[model samples]
Target: MRKTALYPGTFDPITNGHFDIIERALRLFDEVIIAVAISQDKKPMFSLDERIEMTKEAVKSLSNVTVVGFDNLTVELAKAHNASIIIRGLRAVSDFEYELQLGYLNNSLDDTIETVYLMPKLQNAFVSSSIVRNLLKFNGKTDHILPKEVQKIIGNMTSCTLH
Candidate 1:
């Protein structure tokens, strides 16, 4: 049987860190799905469409990966995609507590689903969606952290819609 994994996140603006995780994920699972969350509470800077498009473009070269927008329970999303594993990226020690809580919660919600944590490359480790947004707000150089495709999409925008 093919092993499929679901990687869910707001992905307000996908960073190199995200690419790192996805590329690494491709190695472990037969197929990987990037679930872009519709986080109403976060009031995202990028629209759901924009986030999905951005993710699609960024991962275009990669095989066995899908980019999708979802607004339901993650486990439900996983089930819909037939994903048995949930992939989470851990960038720092601070992220562990929250991610661990989420792992347990998701396991409680569906004991059949398993959560796996992976870390990005060292250079991309500290990069995150929030940090990318903050840098863009100030016209900061994010070339080191953002994928070229993301920089293009974000550049085309005419205004700042801070979350």
Candidate 2:
């Protein structure tokens, strides 16, 4: 059987930590779908098209990875992609509480689907989209924490553009 996993997130701007999780997920699944969520409540800095483009560019070298956008529940997205597993990245203990709840909720939504948690490299553990956004907002250097393509997008943007 072909094993497929779905990794869904807003990915306002894909970060190195998110990239790290994608790389690691590729090792365990035949195809890992990077689902960029069209979040309704949270307004993202980048448009969905921009997020998808940046994510595609960031993972262009990985043949087994695919980037797509979704505006539905993650479990529904997983089912649509024929994925039996949902991959969530765990950064710290604080992340676990929310992730655990999400895992249970998703599992309840679709009993056959399973949620898997993966941790990025320790160096990337501290990096997150919100942090990167804050860094960019203050003109703090975020090149070290973001992917090249993402860096370029933020590099060209003024603080006013983010809002």
What local lDDT score does residue 106 receive in model 1, on the 0 to 100 scale?
Answer: 100
Please provide, for model 2 over 1-163, each residue's C-alpha lDDT reduced to its tens digit, 9 standing for 90 to 100. Answer: 9999999999988999999999899999999999999886788878899889989988998888999998888988898899999999999999999999999999889999999999999999999999987887787998899999878766676555776
Provide the lDDT at 32 for model 2: 98
Instruction: Please count the clashing residue pairs in each candidate, in the order shown.
Output: 0, 0
Q: What is the TM-score of each candidate against the true structure?
A: 0.96, 0.95
Q: Quick one: best TM-score, which candidate?
A: 1
**In model 2, which residue pairs have backbone atoms overlapping below 3 Å?**
none
Model 2, TM vs. native: 0.95
What lDDT does the true structure give each of the candidates?
Answer: 0.94, 0.90
The runs of at least 3 residues in candidate 2 whose Cα sits more than 4 Å from the true structure, single-residue gaps closed, are: 157-160
For model 1, residues 28-100, the per-residue Cα lDDT tens digits are 9999999999998998888899999999999999999999999999999999999999999999999999999
Model 2: ten consecutive residues of lowest lDDT: 153-162
